[model samples]
Target chain A: MRSTLLIAWTVLIEAIRRREVYAIVVISTLLIGAVATTRFFELQGLGKFYREIALQIMTIATNLTVIIIASRQLPREFESRTIYPLLAKPVSRLSFMLGKLIGVMAAGTFCFLLFMLVFLAGCQYLKIFVSPPLFAQFLFLQILGLLVVATLSFMLSLMTNLDAAITLGSLFYLLSSIFLSALSYLYQFSDTAVKFILRVMVFSVPQMSLFDLSEKVVHQEVWPPVPAFVIGQLTAYSLAFSSLFFLVAFLLFRRRPL
Target chain B: MNNSSAPLIEVRNLVVEYASRGGAMRAVNDVSFTVLPGECIGFIGPNGAGKSTTMKVLLGFMFPKSGSVKLFNREPGATEARRRLGYLPEVTLYYPFMKAKELLFLYGGLQGMTRTQLKVRIPKLLEEVGLAGRGDTLLKNFSKGMQQRVGIAQAIIADPELLILDELSSGLDPVGRHDLRDVMLELKKAGRTIFFSSHELSEVETLCDRVIMINKGRVVLESPVAELMKPLNLFEIDFEQDGQPQTRSVSGAEKFNATLAEIISSGGRVIGTRTATRSLEDYFIEIIRGHEGSGR
Candidate 1:
């Protein structure tokens, strides 16, 4: 566990010192700032629109940052030959990889925290009524979803090159909701074998849409916070898929000759 | 620490392969050797002769197709085995964002050293490696030679009982190489077992108690460095040519005598004569060429 933390600390240090996350936060703040300051032609649902746009921007910026950083971690280590001296020590490969996963998550959390601060500042300027419960759920679920994306990115990085891994991870996040919705609709009309395949696909990949609560946060006045049972199921769903992806990555990496 | 008198490293029938368009290409073919405890063994081989591949398998970074490799008679990369080991890779780049001290701390921490231990050792280790008072400098600003010094520092930070160094003098300037030699000699006196490969045969000759030379993924020669250096000798004739000094070297007394007589007869004043010995470099080139010639 200590080895894992040390390795994770290195990754976090790289993210912090590189100053790339700060750039993401700055860009997000600008987008949120522009939207917050706009008149929107004196629309009636201006608060909801602002909330919707700000949360979406934060989600996109944070998730993409997580995916990109996670995808590059292993490939960069191998390419730069940095893994040589690192693996030469008394550390195990499993610990090294776990450290990387946790580090990437830590970086994502740091990025998310910055985005959250900017987002809240935007809301404050607009005097919007934000429900604490729904906002908390939204934040927690988004991090859980980032873990899923991070693990998938790690697996893809091991199986393929860096760019392809990043592109695939981001594209999957963008299209997973549509893919799941389409699978559900197509299962009703498909033949037996196709339906079985669709069912397998449904369970094979994470249902990212299940982790999103942004819409609830945006319309908090219309609905109460999610119950504990749903949160439990979502947590289990994230852990299951993340484990699958992380297991594949570890298997590929354990015996690879660097 | 594997302190018993057993071999520090043992390998037998080790075969490693890589997948290519030409089917499975073998990089190491039935190579075998053993390194005894407290012995400084030099693993010398031509490029692509499987030195790094063998080291990777010992570190468990690579899996063998068929063979047994053991450090301390345990499975390679067992935690107990690794804890007693320190390795310097043939080529590596430290994290550019990390300072020298920070990098050492990370490596030392992985070796189970606490912060207090690192704090006491890092400054002195840096000075020993010739990088005094530069611990806080980021690695990005360091030259390749300076980075190699940092590599040396990190490798010895934990003071392991066994050290595996690949390309021991790579990327180092003359001063860096000298400092490393001094450090390695100290480790040798301290009874640390070392297995390392280097293209610099002179460094091997100076530091290695025994040497295992390989070519084309096969062991060509394995012997004590003393045994090899004993029979190999060279003689030199120092003379003046055009009011300037010159030296001519030859392998045998017959050739040395002839050259000396010729210089004197041609009105070149002979200043002195001395006997020297053949170097590990000469022996390495000769063996490799002979091996290739036999193959042809």
Candidate 2:
């Protein structure tokens, strides 16, 4: 575990220095900045518009960057053969994969935090009324979603090359985000076999949309009657799936030809 | 602390295979060898000779299809074993966006070397590798030789007991190759066990005490370099004349007699007819040619 932490810390720091984190920051800033600057005339409340745009930007930035960054993370190492030196050390395959997951997640969290700050500053300058805790929950969800995405990306990288991993990871990300929604609709039908298959698929995917309470907050709906339970579910979901993915990734990497 | 100091690495019939489009292709076939501490062993082979595959399996990057590999008598993949092992892959691929310091720090941290240790050791290593002032430069901007130096530094950062270096001089110029050779000699003198893999026979010839030559996934020969280089049965008769020494085709024992008769006839004397002593390059070529006909 000490070794794992050390490895994770190294990976995290390198991720920062490698400008992968900065790339996320610059792109997120641009996204939020553009959205915040957009003029919405009929919406009456300027603060509301800024807050809404900020939330949207934060969500999109975290989701897209996490997928793009994390998907290429391990595949790049494998392709470049940099993983050889690290794996040649006294690190377990599990530790290596987990370190990468943590590193990518840390990058996501840092990027989202930066996005959140920019949004807050924009809101303050615009005198917009924004829900800090609600926004915090949204950021938390984005982090969880990113963690799930990172795990899936790690798995895909182990199974395929960079381009194929990216394509498959993006598909998985899209599916997980809307998986439950698709299942909810499928559940509406009375057909048993179709509903069963949809349920199985939902359970198999990361159930990413479960963390999405931002839409509720945006629509002025009752902001999640069960915040703690939802957080717990997302936490357990991320940990379990991430562990499973790491196991699969490790097996794949162990068997892979160097 | 001689031969009885315990083997740094041990392998018993190790096998490694890959899942190919057609079927499972065995990359390393029932190969086995051992390296004792302080022994500088050369892993020489032709291309696709399973040298890298064996190294990868020993490093736990790839598991064997069969047989057991042990590092310091522990399971090869065990963390304890890994902690003591150092590896420089044939490809000196670093995170291109990372500065030399960041890359070394990452590698040091992975090896569980503390920050304090890194502070003291990194500069020393950089200086040793002659990259003292370039720590701030990103690896991507560095030349291939520079990257190779950093790669060497990364391998030795942890002060591992077992060093596994693959093609350490593959891309280096002659001077760079000499520099790498000097580093390997220094490591060996410091009581570290080193397993170096390369197709360049000269590099291995100068550095290794024992050479294990592999061709096409199997060990073609394994012996002390001195013993392997001992005079072979085939003789090279310089003939005291040039112009492609005349040859007559004959079979088996007749070939030897014909050569001796030619030498005796052409010789105002036998004029130093001696058994062949091949250079490392000649031996390498012979092994490669042997590969063309034999699957192994």
Candidate 3:
């Protein structure tokens, strides 16, 4: 565990030093700043519009950053031959994979939180009321979604190059968000064979939409209180999906020739 | 810890294969050797000769297709075995963002060294590797030779019992190579086992107790340096030519004596006479060529 944390620490330091993280943060902040300073004071439902756009931007920035960084982790290490020295030590392959996952997740979470802070300050300045619990839940679910994305990115990275992995990760996220909701609508009219294929597809890809609560936070009139049972279900789903991808990545990495 | 009976590294009929477009290609084929404690063994081979592949198997970076390889009687990837071993790869690539001291501390920590131990040892190692007072410099600014020095420092940071280095003299000037040779000699004096692969046969001849030569993934010859350097049947006769001494090798003893007597009779002044011994380079070439000629 200590060795794992050491690797995690090293990776976090490396990620923090990268210019992309800072650039993403700066862009997110500027977007939020523009929204906060806009002349929407006399507009109806301005708070909802501001909340929706701000949360969407934050989500996109965080997810994009996470996917880019996670997909590049293993491929960069192998391409640069930096993995040689680390593996030459007494560290196990499993520990190394876990460390990378944890590090990327931690870095992603840090960036997400920073963006949230900026958004929240904007909300306060605009006199937009936000329930603290709902905001916290939004942050938690978004981070959980990012975790799923990160694990999938890592797994794809083990199988392909950095660019392909990143493209696949982006497509997965985009398709999951778009197609997951249509599964129920498509199920009613589909034949048995089509239904079976759709079922397989649904079961294979993570239901990332399940973790999205941005709409609820934006429109309080439509917001339903999330009970402990729903949170438990969401957490279990995220954990199961992340674990499956992480295990596949570990097996692939173990067999890799380094 | 002082037992001399057990070999520090042992391999038996090891084989490693990689998947190529032309089916599986063997990188190491039935190669076996041993390194006893405190013995400095030089692994000499031509390019694509499987030296690095064999070392990778021993270091757990690559697995063997068949047979066994062990360090300290434990599996190569076992923590106990890895704890006692240090490796410097042929191309040492480190994170360019890290400073020299930070890199050392990271490796030292992985070896389970305490903070206090690293605090003292990092500087001492930097100094020993000719990078004194430069520990705070980022690795990106370092030249290839300087990076090689840092590689050596990281390899020996934990004071490992067995040190495995690949091409240690690469990317170094004459003075740098001389300094490394001195450091390696010091490590040998401290009873550390060193097994390194190199194309530099002269360095091997000067530093190694024994040399193991491999060609085409097979062992060609393994002998003590002294035995390999023994004088052959040829003799060299040097005589004055254009105010300079020019030497020529005479194959047969009769021809050598006849040439010496002729030089004396002609008053050409025999500057020196000595038996000719094949250097490591010559023997390496001869063995490799012999294998090629045999259709291996």
lDDT of each: 0.89, 0.76, 0.87
**Candidate 3 to native Cα RMSD, angstroms:** 2.5
- The C-alpha stretches of model 1 lying farther than 4 A from their native spots are A41-44, A191-193, B1-4, B231-270, B293-296
lDDT of 1 at B285: 88
lDDT of 2 by residue, B189-280 (tens): 89888899886788788888888888778887888887767766665544444444443333345576687686677643444545566777
lDDT (tens digit, per residue) of candidate 1 on B1-296: 23457888999999989889979888888889999888999999889888998999998888899989999888987888888898888767889999999999899999999999989999999999999999999999999888888888888888998899988889998888888999999999998998999988889999999999888777889999998888545887888988999988898888888888889888899989877766788878888988884431
Which candidate number has the best DockQ? 1
Flag clash pairs in model 3: none
Docking class of 1: medium
TM-scores for every predicted model: 0.92, 0.84, 0.93
For A1-258, candidate 2 gives per-residue lDDT tens digits of 765665566556665666655776677677667766677654445445656666766776677667676777777776788878878877777677777677778877877777767877876666665555776676677676777777777778767777887788777766655666767876898488887887787778777667676665554434644467767877888788877887787787765655
Higher-ranked by lDDT: 1 or 2: 1
- Candidate 2 residues lying further than 4 Å off, grouped into runs, are A14-31, A34-44, A172-182, A192-206, A216-230, A237-257, B229-277
DockQ for each numbered candidate? 0.71, 0.52, 0.67
Comparing 1 with 3 on lDDT, the higher-scoring candidate is: 1
Give the number of the best model, judged by TM-score: 3
